[model samples]
Target: MPTLEVNFLGYRIKSPILVASGPASHDVKQIPIAQEMGAGGVVLKTVVSDKFDYMRYWPRPRYKLIDWDKKMNGKSQYFTLYSYEQAYSGSIEDYFKFVKISKSTSNIMIIGSAFADEPKDWIYLAKGIEEAGADAIELDISSPHKPGTMQFETHFIQAIKSVVENVKIPVLVKLAPGPDVLHQAKVCKELGADAVTLCNRLRGLEIDVESQKPILHGYYAGVGGPWAKYYNFKHVSEVYNEVGITISATSGVLNWIDALKYIMLGATTVQVLSAIIVNGWETIRQINEGILNFMIEKGIEDLEKIRGVAARNLVEPDLIVRWSGEKKSGPRNVFDDW
Candidate 1:
């Protein structure tokens, strides 16, 4: 039998599929559910500092599933999860208690997620999370719903530095999906971060045509779909190529294939949320089963054998064969010479 076990931040997990920080990971009650569903770990819902207290109150009807009913081959296929959901809807103290209780009750790895602007606040939250017995801490600097004008340059660098310095546990930095991702990942590595979570959801807006207004709370919301994995896949591959930091790929993993794609592109683990929201908790178990079956068929005993294989094998642009631009007839690949 093939094993789904993978090591993340030096901690062994039963599977590489972690429940991403979102509504599915907001409550302590969800911990046992995730473990039972065969998830390796859960990045607890991001908690904010007291200064960002207003982020705790999310608007009612915050979730909207756009194009969810679209299907192919008699199966629901694509969707855009647009949401205005913010940080964990609780005080920092409440979050501390939540982490403490979850850590005590759950056998699976529990990582506490936190978002804050100031270095002091970052240290405070990191200390609290460490005190709560979390196995690790992930700095949620790239949350789409982050407030005010906190950029990675002026704001997050110091906070990340402080958190890494203050915490005894492994520190993972969750970065946004943008052109600067590789640079930010390099910075995380230089600052002593143990890992980087490639790509958070992009901030986006949807409008109602009839009302001629923004839909769902009249504000821009975090947006992601299955297509998101493509760019993040590129990001993971590039970051893995250049920065070489541990990566926990997230944003658009909907199945075992998606999970395997991340691992192939150099991700140590894959985080999933939108899939669970749409497909139910069984999705985790299903993905684990799918991966195990694939490994067994491939005659592989461990996942590490395939990790980063695709990234390492990427074809350089200069080496790619290009079409000769001589009015070619019939069908041919863009890279194929006429």
Candidate 2:
């Protein structure tokens, strides 16, 4: 009733709530249920260049995530047991088929999440997704797990440029949180991306110190928790401060407060995972309802009004005037003698 429509490139979504790219969006059957549960849109689990790998398995292509804490809803690290490039992802036939079906009925857009082997492969992936009838293509450049799975900001610019060049449809570059995020967004915009999904899973590790074994089959995984909320907001604020880019805020968006904080920090939409895994899919409706009610109470009608309201509130050396704050001591440059 609150009219929560938002933009995904040129396309329109019923609300700002989206399912983050994960195990939840593997096949066609899950699509209907996700929509019924009030998902504004659902990004398909990343499609890699290796269509042969996907062909070996049907709708239930399986991957495992390591529990950092090994506790449900507890502190954890999630890494794809199996990984590949998402841009040129999956069997082209099945990827196209999923897109065609998802966009047919519901207002929810089918965003194909793609990772490619190299720059040349991006255009094929983007054009393929657009031709396949997806509303948009989400280039997953920021994800921690890929064929090489290297540091995020380092390779992001090249990845964005390649994807934006190849596709005529709206291209969304998912970026990780870091000092370089603002520059990365500018690069995406300059290269002609429509939107930016912020803060990919942060790198973290879990060791079985007792057994002296590694918990994850991979070296490290992305960290997720209730604690990630503030970090997400900070990253979003930085992007909003530097320029206006359509942002999909991610990480630990667990409550209405966390969602509102992101909106105030200029996120166009908020994606969730850990909460849905913990509470249930119905949480979307509740989150939507809560956000809508708060907006009305605070005199917010549209999504843009609250974007970056907290940008000026960010902590900076210039902003802190308190004399009681951490006082500077003498420089410990004793190594100068060496």
Candidate 3:
């Protein structure tokens, strides 16, 4: 029988489908549930430094499912998960306790996540997470909801470097999905980061046209949906080919197919959040079973065999073959003039 196991950050995890660090993973109670449901690992909810303690308290109605009524083939699988939630909603000490209890209760790999503005705080949080027995640490410097004026070059670069130098456990840096992903991924590799989570949610605003105002907290919120996987896929592919670093894909994973797409495009692990929150925890088991079934159908024994296959085969834009258009046709397609 084929297995879903894969090695990430020098640790063998049961599956590549990790529960992303969001509402599903913010509480210690969710850890055992994730493990029981067949998650490879879980990036614990990000603990923020006291400098951004305001993120701890969320609005009364922070989540809104946009385009929920729109459906295709009788399924509403596409929708934007708009929310204003940030940080672990707990004290830093409480976060350490949460990680410790999670590690004790579940055998699943626990990757601690944290956000801070200062390199010293990053080092301090990483050390505390390591002491709490986390398998790895992910620096969440790319959160769409991050406050203040912290730039990657000035703030996050030093934070990543400091944390990597200080932490004994593997360190993963999470970056935003933007044009600079390739450059940032290379920087992470040079800084000795064990892995890079390709892309976090984007900062977006939804409008309540009826009221002529923004929706959900009346401010720009972290937004992601099934459509997000495509850009993240591109990020993973580019980072894999150019930077050659371990990639943990996050954002827009709605099902096993989405997870498999990330794996094929060079992500060693795929972190999922919106799907679980929109669907249920059973989505974890479903994703694992789906991958196994696919492997059996294809007679593939290991994930490594297919990892980065799609990325390696990416056709350069200059080499793309286009129709000569010697034979003209009516407006059947826009490429008739090509």
Candidate 4:
């Protein structure tokens, strides 16, 4: 059988599929469920600093699913999710407890995630998570809904560097998807981040034509769906080609094929969230099985064989070999003459 085991940041994991740091990992019970469902690991929901007020945005969280068919039937697959949500509401102490419990109860890796306003707070949480026995720390600096709390680019790099300096465990920076992603990943790698999650949701707005209002709480919210997978693949491949850092590919992975695309683009692991929210936990098992079957059929024995193979072949458009002699016998479009 092909081995799915991966050595990520000096730690071995049974599989490359990880439950992303979101609603699926928000509760302690959910962590174990993901483990039982055949996930390789779970990134706990982002825990904020003690001074951060959770109650202010706790009244009523909003989320909506937009389907192409408009009927919203089970058979229809494509969807766009619009959500207005914030960081984890629980206290840091409680988050520590959750990490400890997950570690004791499951063999799968447990990654503690955190985000805070101050650099000192980032260090404090990273230390606490390390002491709590988390396998790694995922620094969440990419939530699109929470803009005010996000640090400036320079400050973000400084915070990551400080956390990496203070923690003995591996630190992974979760970055937002944008033109600056490649630069951000390069900075994190230079500052000693062991790995980087390629992306989080993009900020977007949807308007209701008749009501003249926004679909999600009248504010721009985090947007994601199957359509975003193309962008995810493009960015992940580009980052791998340029920065050459270990990547935990996140956002827009909805199936095993999507996961495979990430691995082929040099990601050490693939994180899933929107798929689980749309489908169910069984999606994890199905994806794992699909990968295993595909490997068996392809005569491949290890993930390393395919990792970054496509990226190695990527070349600039101008460098592509082209046929100098033209004028084939095929019919041409009217625009070709113009």
Best by lDDT: 1
The sequence of per-residue lDDT tens digits that candidate 1 reaches over residues 14-102 is 99999999899999899999999999999999999989888999998999999888887765667899999998998899999999999
Candidate 2 deviant stretches above 4 angstroms: 51-90, 147-156, 216-218, 312-316, 323-338
Which window of 10 residues has the lowest lDDT sum in candidate 2?
A: 79-88
Over 95-140, each residue of candidate 4 has an lDDT whose tens digit, in order, gives 8998999899899999999887678999999999999999999998
Candidate 4 lDDT at 331 equals 67
Candidates sorted by TM-score, descending order?
3, 1, 4, 2
Winner on TM-score (2 vs 4): 4
TM-score of model 1 relative to the true fold?
0.95
* lDDT (C-alpha, whole model) for all candidates: 0.92, 0.71, 0.91, 0.86
Q: What is the C-alpha local distance difference test score of candidate 2?
A: 0.71
Clashes of 3: 0
TM-scores of all candidate predictions against the true structure: 0.95, 0.81, 0.95, 0.92
| Candidate 3 segments whose C-alpha is farther than 4 A from its true place | 324-338
TM-score of decoy 2: 0.81
lDDT of 4 at 95: 86
